[model samples]
Target: MCRPTAPRRGYDYRALIMKLSYQLVEQSWPLAKEFRISRGAKTQANVLLLALSDGEHVAWGESVPYARYGETLTSVSQQIERIMPLLSSQTSGEQLNQMMPAGAARNLVDCALWDLRAKKANASVATLLGLTPASTVITAQTLSIDTKERMAAEARTIGNAQLIKIKLDEHDIIEKMEQIHLAAPQSQFIIDANEAWSFETLIQVLPALAKLNVALIEQPLPSNNDTDLATLSSPIPICADESCHVSADLAKLKGKYQAINIKLDKAGGLTEAVKLMQAATEQGFIIMTGCMVGTSLAMAPAYLLSGASSFVDLDGPLLIAKDRDNGFTFADGQMQPHSSAFWGGENNQTNVELARLFTS
Candidate 1:
């Protein structure tokens, strides 16, 4: 029930009453390689980009419609269109939360609203939220599910990485872990099963994974079957990805997962993401900020959470073949802060022009 705060001194309240215009654009960015996980593989990142304008400042937001969450581009678009008439310059984040259910559709609109507010206020989102912007953050470089040899080779290629996340299924669990560990012994590992493991498989692989310096295990068991985790003790920390979304889900995850993965797409956007992060920290859950396979545009807002996260997995741009102009820069596994003009900052003529191109 958090409401918008009172306007600051010199703020123009009239802007809040202005009529808002919006446009939804579909974009497809090719992946550098096939990204494989327990569910399937994808060669490209299909996203829905949302643009919001108040006849002056323009703001942008992007979200990936994941089939795993029963979200498709058409369905997400319809959800946004249905809610469009309710949105105005006066809409508050809390109001939006009540207006739409948390998912990819809400994520796209929520982020666009944040960007719009920041622009109208002539401030950065970080500054408005009272957070110090990070210059660079250590991000996990992910190795997709593949043959043992190929996965090991990929690990070796990024041997200097501080954190490496490996996607795995229920098959050849120990063998793949051993091979990848041998190839990158210096690097810590995060095993992301994407809910492909059973209680028996997870128990069997725990010892081997612990010995291999695996720092964490992500969603090893299906969301519905994860109650089994509370019954057994695990060596490495367990993180909930698919099982946990909004702050309301945290109560059930207690004693089951040591951590939770906060993806803007999953949390619905930065607005809810901030609430979830604060609640998760207060409950002593390890924070891991992650992302769906997306371009830098999607990562920009999520990057704001890196300072508070113990594990950062915002390497979606690294997996993509190309990124938007002025995208975030990644070097030796660290993602440098993006330009203010790129996203989540004061009004920029460049972004307004870009919005015009997409919306026109």
Candidate 2:
């Protein structure tokens, strides 16, 4: 079975004895346009940033408090605050994973610890994880749910994207897919129903979607109704988003889903995400690395899973009105690797300034 490789040998753990300090900052980034999914719509991305320091080098991580998962900014902050007293410079990511349950609160802390360790070791997180950095990855540009005409217009506007992810609801499933396919015939499509469709609706739309050459269908039924999928004989691959989280969920999803979407927040951070990837791969499931709407800080760590994923959807920054100074760069649906100083690399003057800006 595939597993997360151990950290490189000869790392001096004793040198990290300095007392640890932490801060949680809440911020909101406006969206370029309304981002709508099957469940609802939002105009801004509300995120909590975590900063971990040991009196010298500083590292950062971010997570979006999703109400869909019973998390609000206040609750997430309280979660981190409750655990602050128990944390120390020596606390490892694996230990943090055990101390907290899987959710956005644990996601920030777990990711920040990884960044902190990488900074202390003067190496990138990928280097510490024994992963080769990817030069660039083709990310799926998303088109929010809208009228068929407008959705088609948006699809035409992003004609250059190699992959397009469409957010859909129960209404007009066939019409919308037909319009979008006509508009951007060259681009492969991923239809995300976000748990809006009923089993009957899904049964009705399967053949039409398959005809459109849809690459994947994501979470067409509510997570509670995952058993219904075991009855399906879908032509296109079906990926589990809300239905799957950590590696443990894979067994339950075995006959239901052919693919799984790994989001850092849902998986509790990259630490568990890597393990989920390994487990899902071993079980013969295709992997798609996904993300919540946030910023480059959120996407940077998730990017590590790109090389292992067949479909990459780390396009959070692209939907926002503006991103941080050193966000990931996207061109023609391709995302380039972030600068080392961004998050998971050796500490630099820029990182120190970034921490100051967020903590000040």
lDDT of each: 0.87, 0.87
Question: What TM-score quantifies how close candidate 1 is to the native fold?
Answer: 0.93
Clashes of each: 1, 0
Scored against the true structure, residue 251 in model 1 reaches a CA lDDT of 98
Expressed as tens digits, the lDDT of each residue in 223-325 for candidate 2 is: 9977988988999999999999899999899999999999999999888999999899999999999999999999999999888889999999999998886
Q: State candidate 2's TM-score.
A: 0.93
Provide the global lDDT of candidate 1 against the true structure. Answer: 0.87
Which regions of candidate 1 fall more than 4 Å away from where they truly are?
Answer: 1-18, 356-360
Candidate RMSDs in Å, in order, are 7.2, 7.4
lDDT of 1 by residue, 28-130 (tens): 8888899999999999888888778788777888999999999998789888877887888678888999999999999999888888888888888888777
Off by over 4 Å in 2: 1-18, 347-349
Question: For every model shown, what is its TM-score relative to the native structure?
Answer: 0.93, 0.93
